[model samples]
Target chain A: MIPDDALVTATWDDLIERDGQALALSGNDVSLLSELATAAVLFCAEGDATVSAIAAHLEELFGAPEGADTSAAVREVLTTLQNRGVVSITG
Target chain B: MPWESGTAFRVLIVDAGNQGRSAVGERLLRRHLALNGIPADVIRVTSAGLNADDGLRMDVGAAAQVERLGGNAHGFRTRSVSAAMVEAATMLICGTWWEREELCIRYPRARGRAFTLSEIAHLYEELAVAAPIFDHPRLLDSRLRSSEVPDDFDLPPWEEFEERIVAVCDAIDEATRWIAEIWASMVPHHPQPKADGEEAAEPTCTLDAFGVAVAITCGGSAHEALSIAGKRAWGRCVVEDREAEADLTIVVDPDPDVLADARLTGALAYQDVDTALHHLSSAVTVRAIEARVGQLIMMHAAGLAGPDGSVVGFVAPSGTGKTTLSRTLGAHYGYVTDETLAVAPDLTVLPYAKPLSVIDALTHVKEQWGADSLDLAPLPDAPLRLTRLVILDRRENGPSTPVLTRLGHLEGIAMLAEQLSYLSKIPGQLHALSDLVDAVGGLSLLTYRDVKTVLPLMPVLLAGSRR
Candidate 1:
């Protein structure tokens, strides 16, 4: 999980949505992101955004899917995005 | 895609003559990268012209704009766009659609990587800054239909490239309208809009063949002239029943203002009647194929049926005389389609006898002529069947007699795959294709020097010929 105050930024050029799904492409590599993941990516992409700010924005755009561990899911998405190279997190 | 990756990532900006737009793009992109702390050595940005005059400086107006935009264009010299440049460039952005298309047409391999300056700029903004995405509309919809699974990730490289090229071609066309509108707005005193398409309606016609039918509704200015010309050119496909249902409906209009408005509204519009009809042939053909994308096995080949209904489909590249053979041998057989021939799994041949686009040497325009107008054999009442498939191998100093060499299973399928469209969407697509190859016994490569030499082989090569 990314630290609450860590800097988060997007590294993709274009996020293309095709057939109800969004994909962020880096060179030939394309990563499929869900709707929540998409919103989180946009939130974290803004300059000086932190993990806590990204979760708060997600809280507004998408509420918890009825007792599904919302913060844990957001953390999971951030971790995946970082591993996918679509997002950068730094202390 | 990484800024500091060892894999070389070069972006090449292009325009016709390379004097203005491309120079601005090159300078601006370089400055953009620098502003973001990306080293110039990491990402290479250059510009070229399709037909450049080797050593020319950036246009003065463009250079001034570059300076105004806080970018230096001090030593920018135009370089001719070459095969080497296209090969070296990871991304090629052009100033106009014509340049993009011409480059793509010349080097189909670059089809996937080519983009317009306007398009790449939008991409650049997002790439560099991931600029506060607010659900920006995707540039182009996926070429795959809604039903296709999201497994588009697994497409072969060439197929992916082809799809990207098609998608980009369409997207670039749409993007160009925005560029034009922006230019129009920038001019303080723009010309007033032209009159809309409000002329009296023209005679409507129903065209049906190959199980693919279209109802042509004539509207707009010059509709009467265009309608009559279309009717004349596609008379072979026209039927008596005007009320017959069609698989597709196309509006034939050629009003300039209407065309311009259509472009703005994301509709297919042509500037003039000739242009409309010229593009209509391929557009309609593809539409017909789309209608039966999964239902039929279609190929870019010419089909002709002998008297007893044995139809031989000949696959050949452009300038290899598929049309010539269709027109010449068609006198003694039923002419199907010179462009797209469709077949059902049961071997039933569906004829798409659209007007042939023949090159007129004098005017150098490809004139469309109906099969009946050209005295080509008409579609007979006898049911047509797919009897044989022949790939034409034309050569200058070849044998006097046409030799039919039987092709192997993999060789035939691989060669034929290059010519078919929308096959991937079909269920068991390759298996279906292979079944057709096996069902028809096998395919043959017809190596010949002249059409006359290939003529005699038809009666023997094709089943039910002269029956």
Candidate 2:
């Protein structure tokens, strides 16, 4: 299951309203989060899963583009979210 | 009794030979000051060469370049740079560092008064940071001159030389305005006497870029504080009285409870003026001002003007390094407003020239530093058209190198909307922002940590909208 702390509980507007405009994310970040949120919701439904399993699920659902490394992209996105305090990973 | 009453601020431009460098510098300086609205009667400009023979005309190429820049080249006879000439001049500007040094060596007393054109620009920048309130020209005349005399860089060909002259003229124009603004602020304004028993007019308060106006009802200390802040932010727009009409009215409340409460009532406020001011941050004041002017379509952005009178706006939320980047790039591009960039219906940027809010070390309060205090060139007098927008994405430990990705119209609007001061108040805010995005074509998302990495990309970002 996804940790409560890992999830960005507040919506974009909610965050902006609470912390003022500076906390508002860029459009690209919001889009990236939307994609990640979808994966996150599905991952939570599956309970605890490995990073590879999550990446595989994303690849299967979205389909990896030609010459694109879906696993690395998923890891990078997850790492970015984690760095931004939007997500947390547990063993 | 007086030899000459009200002699103008005389500037003598000197070169090794007056035919070329001195003539060009003189013409540029004179034309620049005149173009920028500094009256000719207020500042007299002349040129002379140290080693020049009497009656030698300006160099053919330099004279043509001066003519091209709309400056007079006729009757430009080269006079020799004498001790008497040096003594007469209030300010002596040299075409080259060597010329300045030679003049200093010949006339030791002229050392403090004489400076190379580039040296004066550098000194102005330095003095702005160190002692912003001092009369720059007078201070520059009295201060100890630099001993270093570097050789002049090779001048470009005649065709390209005109471009350099234009650049020099622009620099002078900016510097002259900066000095005038600072000096003007230091001089206390004396209201003119009423003519023929006319009634005293009600005091009117004009708001600055952030749309903040302080009423005359406030205490003396509060008035003083607000006046300084207002002058720094809006120049001479901060007016007295007008409590009824002002966007924000600050009144000193003597009542203990009211003092403790710090109550805000619509556009009015009751607070312990001294205590409130002591604790109040510029950011909070700006936010309050934004709330007051939220009815108007304004954005929290730093505005800069390019050479072509085009404005590039960097819109971002507070603490996003908008001010930092604006200060860094303002020398190259004229600084408009760092706190609030108000846009007209046609998207022309109104000149704000507000003092920058610098974070105080101990209190961490954002103290207002006058625009002239910063080493930034002044904005040109003409209206600036909005040519570009950049949504800043500065974060700690982010990428070392800045990456600027272009945003689509809708995306640009979305990003810009978040930075809009009074988005909800404006009826068609989104559409207005969308129209601006469409007109400007698109915006760039500037993501980076250090300002240095992003500094080089500013010209590219400014030019990107034109494409």
Candidate 3:
């Protein structure tokens, strides 16, 4: 579930890149996110990124696959990041 | 991480008298270090004996042999062996088999390293054939540890009885050259080709700080300053070679196209080695902290661990007397760091023994000093753990006696999150942090007017009391 206010996130540069995967670190927690998932977390790390904005950006970057609902897809990505404490969805 | 040789290749040769076989070996090994472009000041080659006459001149034969080998033994003096000599020696070479046996029996710690001169020559011959020795820089220092002592190592054998007055003297001379060759092959000279009438460039030193391996190379004043810095500040972290891929390269006035493959490079352009060192300190610290991004949960705190490896992390923001308190606490407990204290998920504390950046009262500039320089206690041999967390609250006229009040999970987590680095990289970090707080019996806010006030509470806090 994505929240309303700002996303508390670390920069892309801070992510630990290993074996073709980027690991987002938060103290004791180390979350290995997929390329698509990493993109959503980084895009939201800009502080004011909304769910709709992230979906549109991802759709434009990777291209929406034949009228796919990317807004729903983006929500799932953000929810995973939220669950991992990679980013906080604060209202 | 593999163990790094923090100290220089300190070779201490022993015999019946320091003047003869041991003296010859010392002079030759010094030549070896010099030819390999390793500064004599950075590396140590000295001799001592169990039954030695202190302040005696080098043996007449040994002195003549040293000169014959193109080395001056004018200043060579004999001294009886001390425990400190045996303890500090990276390689303990004995002229006789009996010396090795006696040396080990007296100093049990040196048992791993104690070797006969003949034994070393034989090991070098065996190791030289095994080309993989080049890949293992520390194996030369550690082969004694891994390999068992030969069964007949205690049996005395003389190579040349009729030729030399002392039976072992001939073998010592022959074996000394071999020892030098082994050192030369291990630490090859710097790539800078010697120009006409110019000496070869000094060798590079690998430093291990906060789990980061940094290789430093430079010439002139920079090299001189770094040599002193390497010994004083990062003495315990200096290794023989770049065994692991270096995390960062600290080069001063480096030739372009040199060290191109390094992951991170901090190059010093100017020849001002003194000023460059101040900047170098900053670079090492920044890179060291960055290297632990995924592995360590680092806090911008000062850590002091008890003798039992129980670490009490004094979590505070910069300029909150963390550094000041560290000096006081360090005298009592093992000082980990005054800057960043990184911990594993299992609560194990990783040592970041960075030079303490202390502010000079008169100069008002932060001077970087090794933990030893400040008379701080060294980290205990035991494995360190984050047993307690103290959120320091320092204010004028706060309390004469420190107050340790527990904070609830919500406030504690928020405060803790502020002091942490790269939180987004960790999965389930917040809950883990909350669990850590609970495990430590809740984060305690220590309100005190003076640094001394907080000292009394360490015993209570480390005891893990709920109050």
- Candidate 1 to truth, TM: 0.52
| Candidate 3: residue B463 Cα off by (Å) | 1.6
Question: Each prediction's DockQ?
Answer: 0.02, 0.01, 0.02
Candidate 3 total steric clashes = 12
Winner on lDDT (1 vs 2): 1
Specify the CAPRI tier of model 1: incorrect
Which portions of model 1 show Cα errors greater than 4 Å? A1-91, B1-203, B240-255, B264-268, B464-467
DockQ of model 2, rounded to 2 decimals: 0.01
User: B298 in model 2: Cα distance from truth in Å?
Assistant: 1.6
Writing each residue's lDDT as its tens digit, candidate 1 over B62-172 gives 776677667787988889988789867766777776888888877654565776655543443222110001001111111111112221112234658556434433343
Give a tens-digit lDDT track for model 3, residues B273-323: 444455455445544554565566767678998888888889876556787
Candidate 2 lDDT, tens digit per residue, A2-91?
432332222222112111112223211222234444564346434655666776677777788468777667766665544333344664
* Model 3 chain B lowest lDDT segment of ten: B128-137
